[model samples]
Each structure stands twice: as C-alpha cells, then as structure tokens.
Target: MLIATWNVNSVKQRLEHVLRFLDEARPDVLCLQELKATDEAVPALEIEAKGYNLAVHGQKAFNGVAILSRFPLSDIRRGLPGDPEDIQSRYIEALVSAPSGRVARVASIYLPNGNPTGTDKYSYKLRWMERLAGHAAGLLRLEEPLVLAGDYNVIPDARDVSNPEAWVEDALFRPETRSAFRRLLGLGLTEAVRACDDKPGLYTFWDYQAGAWQKNKGIRIDHLLLSPQAADRLTGTEIHRHTRSWDKPSDHVPVSVTLDI
Candidate 1:
C-alpha cells in the first residue's frame, strides 16, 4: 500500500494542488494536516469524486487533520486521547482495509509548533508530546500495521535543518523537542524516511520568507512513523520536493512510504 502525508497549509487554498497530486501520485491513502477549515468548509464532494473516503477532524481557521483513503475506512476516531480539554483538531485515525484483505491503522498528526520559547505554548507542546508518547506505547502493543504520518513540526536533528545554529533558539529544533521525538521512537516506532535513506539534505518543508525555498533552505519536519508490522513491509520512501516549486504551493511538501502489507 502507498501511504502519504502532507500539511496542505490550508485545504481550501491548496485544493487544486492537492487534486493534481492525487491524480498524479495515486497513493492508496493520504493523511492531511493543517486543513484550516471546518468540516463543512472542506470540499468533500470534490474529494469524494476522486474515489477516496474522507475522515476529517477539522477546526475553524487552524489546526485540522484528515485521512483520505481509497479503501473503506472503519473505526474512525477523532482527537488524541488523554486531554479532555485539549480541543485542537490535530489528530484523526482510522483502520483501512485494503482490497487484498490487509488492514493498517493510520493517523494524521499536526504536532504543536511551539514558537517563542519559554512560554506557555512551549510547555503545552511538551505536554502534548508526553501524551502522544503514552498513547503510542499502548498502540505498540496492538502489534498490527500502524502508521503515524503528518507534519510533526519537529526537526529531529541538526542534520534535518539547513543551518543548525539558526534554529537553536527555535522551538522546532530545541533539544527538548528532539528528546521528545526520540522518546516516541523509543516506543518501537521506525521513522520511515530515515529507515529508507539516511542521507542528509532530505528535507520536507521550506519557509516562504527569506527566499527559503529558492535557496533550498529547508527542514525535514514532516514524517511517517511505522510500527514493527508496517516497518517490516516497508518497500520505499520519497519526499515530493518538486511540489514545493508548484504554483501556490504549500511551504511543506508530501512525504510518502510504500509497504508490502
């Protein structure tokens, strides 16, 4: 199965780009983040016409997630567990049954981008990571094919960013944030891109300002984390860097992985 993840920035604004990608890439499943729209606002009919089922967890003007799959989606769940009052539409999961009778559990995640360090937002980001770690630990026990894919808003290492010193004070590359990511991996999850290719300069996102994309100043913040079952079947991985140069493209591009399962 070919599964992909993309932070569209705003689904409405990037609908055309997304449609073009869907038609060309033809991934079996796509996990979307940063819809920046409510469920009613999403172009559901347009997407449905493409032969994909939609599972959306959306918000008004920020932080939304969705899962689009060619296969039937079952047991759809919205929102990350462990924080009742946390209402950000950052997570959505579903079980997709492929035509070959293979089942895979997948989730779209838009992890917090805690900017302006030493503030409440940074604290919340860390707490959210902890909650995610706890939830991931439980999911690991299921021992099924599981994929957590989306914009993690995290630069896992100095190698992931264009300039290590430039991001030292930024939340995305903070030591604590990287540690949290490491803890998630410690739960027995395999980062798909790194597993397939450990080479440097494999970035997934670039800022619109300061000629970031023009200069190839990018970072690998988006990811697809696979469980043992899914990792075992991992066949290939790709970063659709070309998408960044498209018309009205999002700052982030699509990251994908193929699995035999």
Candidate 2:
C-alpha cells in the first residue's frame, strides 16, 4: 500500500493542488497536516467524492491534521494524549485495512514551529516532544504495523538542511530539537525515508521567501516513522519535489512510502 504525508499549509488555499495530488499519486492512505480550518470548514464532501474516507482534527486559521484513506477508517482518535490542556489540533490517528488485508495504525501530526527560540513557545515545543515520546513508547509496545507520519517541523541533522549554520538559531534545527527527534527514533521506530534512502540533500520543504525553492534551498522535515512491522514491509519512498513548483503550491511537498503490507 502507498501511504503519504503532506503539510498543505492551508487546506482551503491548496484544495486544488491537493485534489490534483490525490489524482496523480493515488495513495491508499494520505496523512495531511496544517489544514488551518475547522472541521466544518474542511472540504469533506469533495474529498469523499474521490472515493476516500475522511478523518480530520482541525482548528481555525492554524494547526490541523487529517487522514484520507481508500479503505474504511476505524478507531479514529483526534488528539495526542498526555496533555489535557493542550488544545492544538496537531494530531489524528486511525486504523486502516490495506488491500493486502493488513490493518495498520497511522497518525498525522503538525508539530509546532516554535520560531525565534528561547521563549515560551520553544519550551512548549520541548514539552510537546516529551509527551510525544512517551506516547510513542506505549505505541511501540503494541507491536503492530504503525506509521507516524506528517510535517515534523524538525531538521533531523545538518545533512537534512540546506545550510546548518543558517538554521542553528532556528527552533526547527536547534540541538535540543534534534536530540528530541533522536529520542523518538530510539523508541524502536524506523524513519522510513532514511531507511529506504540514505542519500543526503534530499529535502521536503522550501520557504517562499529568498527564492528558496528556485535555489533548491530546502529541508527534510516531513517524515514517516514506521514501527518494526511496517518497516519490514517498506518497499519504496518518494519526495514529490515537483509539487513545490506547481501553481500556488505550498512551501511543503508530499513525502511518501510504499509498503508491502
């Protein structure tokens, strides 16, 4: 089955691009981040018309996540556990049965950007990572086919970014942030892209400013962390870099992995 993750920036603004992608990629399951709309505002009707089930956790004008699957989605969960007061619509998970008759658990997450480090936002970002780590540890115990995919808003390493020095002060590439990401991987999760492709300079996001895309100045922030079961079936991975050049495209592009399961 083909599973993909994309941070659409704003689902409403990029609805056309999204529709086009859904047609072109034809993934069995697609995890979306940054919907920037409420549940009522999401274009569920149009999506359903494409023969997919929709599950969304949305917020107004900000963070949101969703999952679109060709198969029926069950046990839908709307928020990340461990933080009762944390209301950001950054996570949503569901169970999807692939054509191969394998049931996999998947989640779409839009991690906080936490810009201009050394502030409350940065602290919150760290705390959120901790909570995610704890949750991931528990999920690992399930020993099922699990895919944690989305816009992680993290630069895992200098090799993942266009210029390490340029992002040193940014929250996304901070040392602490990278460490947190490493901790997540330490929980027995396999980063699908890295596992399938080790080549450097492969990126998933580019800024709109400073001719980032044109200059190929980008970073690999979007990711798919697969459980051991899913990792064993990993067949291929792709970064839809061409999408960045499309009309009114989002700064981020789709990252996908094909699994035998």
Candidate 3:
C-alpha cells in the first residue's frame, strides 16, 4: 500500500493539481493539508468522482485537512485532542484497510507555521507541539500500523534547509521547534524519508519568492512519521518534487511511502 501526504495550500485554487496528483501518484491513501476552505466549499463531488473515499475537516479560508482513501475509512477523528480551544481544522485521522484487509491508522496534520518567534503565535505553536506529542504518545500504546503524516512546519535539522543561517531564527527552524519534533520521534516514530534516504537537498517545500524553486533552494518540512509497526512495513519512499513544477504549483509537493501491508 502507498500512503502519501501533500500540503496543497488551498483546495479551491489547486483543485486541478490535486486531481492531477491523484491520477499521477494513484496512492492507496492521500493525506492533504492546508485546504483553506470550508466544508461546503471543498469541491468534494469533483474529488469523489475520481474514485476515492474522502474525509475532511475544514475551516473558512484557513487551515484545513483531509484524508482520501482508495478503500473505506472508519473511526474518523476530526480534531487533535488535548486542546478544546484550538479550533483550527488542521488535523484529521482515520482507520483504513489495505487490499489484504490489513488495518492501519493515518492522520493528516498541518502544524502551525508560527512565524516571527516572539509572539502568542509562537507560544501557541509550542503548546500545540506539546499537545501533539502527548497525543502521539497515547497513540503509540495502540501498537498498530499508524502513520502521522503532513506538512509539519518544522525543519528537523540543518541538513533539511538550504541555508542553515537564513532559517536559524525562523520559527520552523528554531531550536524549540526542532526539539518538539524530536520529542515526537523520541516516542519511537520513525521519519519515513530519513529512514529511507538521509541525503540533504531532498526537500519538499520551496518558497515562491526569491526564485527559490529556480535556484533549487528549499526545505524538507513535510513528513510522514510512522509507528513501529508501520515502519516495519516501509518498503520505499519518494519525494515527488516534479509536482512543484506544474502550472500554478503549490510551494510544497507530495512525499510518499510504500508499505508492505
């Protein structure tokens, strides 16, 4: 089974790209982030017409997420636990089965961008991370094939970004941010990409400004963190950088993992 994640930026603006990706990758499950549209405006009909089961948590012109499965999805979760006040539609999880009837859990996460580190936004980012860590810890107890994948909004290491100095003070690359991400991994979740290939420059996101794409200047902020059981079935991983070059492209591209379920 192939599971993939992509931050489409906005489902409305990138509907074509989303449909194109579905046709191109043909993943068994595709987790999407940054929908930036309300539930009623998600273009669900167009997507469902492509032959996939859709589960979405949406917000108006802001953070939103969804999960699309070629197979059925059950036990759908709409929000991240541990925060009653966090109304952002940034997370959605569901239980899905592979062709072999092998069940697994998957989540689409769009963590806060927390830009300019000295404000409530940054604080909220930190708190959210802690909450995510706590929730992830609890999920780990399930001992099932679980994949927590999305645009994490974190640069895990110096090797993840193009210029270490340029991003040092940015929230995504800040020490606290990276540390929080490590806490998640410390819970025994294996980062699929690094586990398969540790090479630098294998980035998933690129800034549209400053000719970032033209210069191949990018960062690897999107990720697929797999639980122990899921990690064990990981057969391969791919960074679909070509998607970033499509007309009217998003800053991010899809990253996928093939599992032996």
lDDT tens per residue, model 3, 1-261: 899999999999999999999998899999999999998899999999999999999999999999999999999999999989889998999999777889989999999999879999999899999989999998899999999999999999999999999998999999999999998999999999999998888899999999999999999999999999999999999999999999989999999999888
lDDT of 2 by residue, 5-124 (tens): 999999999999999999999999999999999999999999999999999999999999999999989999999999999999999999998766779999998998888698999998
Model 1: per-residue Cα lDDT over 1-261, one tens digit each: 999999999999999998998999999999999999999999999999999999999999999999999999999989999999999999999999999898999999999999988999999899999998998888889999999999998999888988989999999999999999999999999999999898889999999999999999999999999999999999999999999999989999999999997
After the best TM-score superposition of candidate 2, give how far the Cα of residue 165 lies from its true spot, in angstroms.
0.7
- lDDT order, best first, reads 1, 3, 2
Could you tell me which residue pairs clash in candidate 2? none
Pairing residues by index, what is the TM-score of model 3?
0.99
* Candidate models: Cα lDDT each: 0.95, 0.94, 0.94
Residue 207 lDDT (model 2):
95
Model 3 bad stretches (over 4 Å)? none
TM-score of each: 0.99, 0.99, 0.99
- Cα displacement (angstroms), candidate 3, residue 141, comes to 0.7
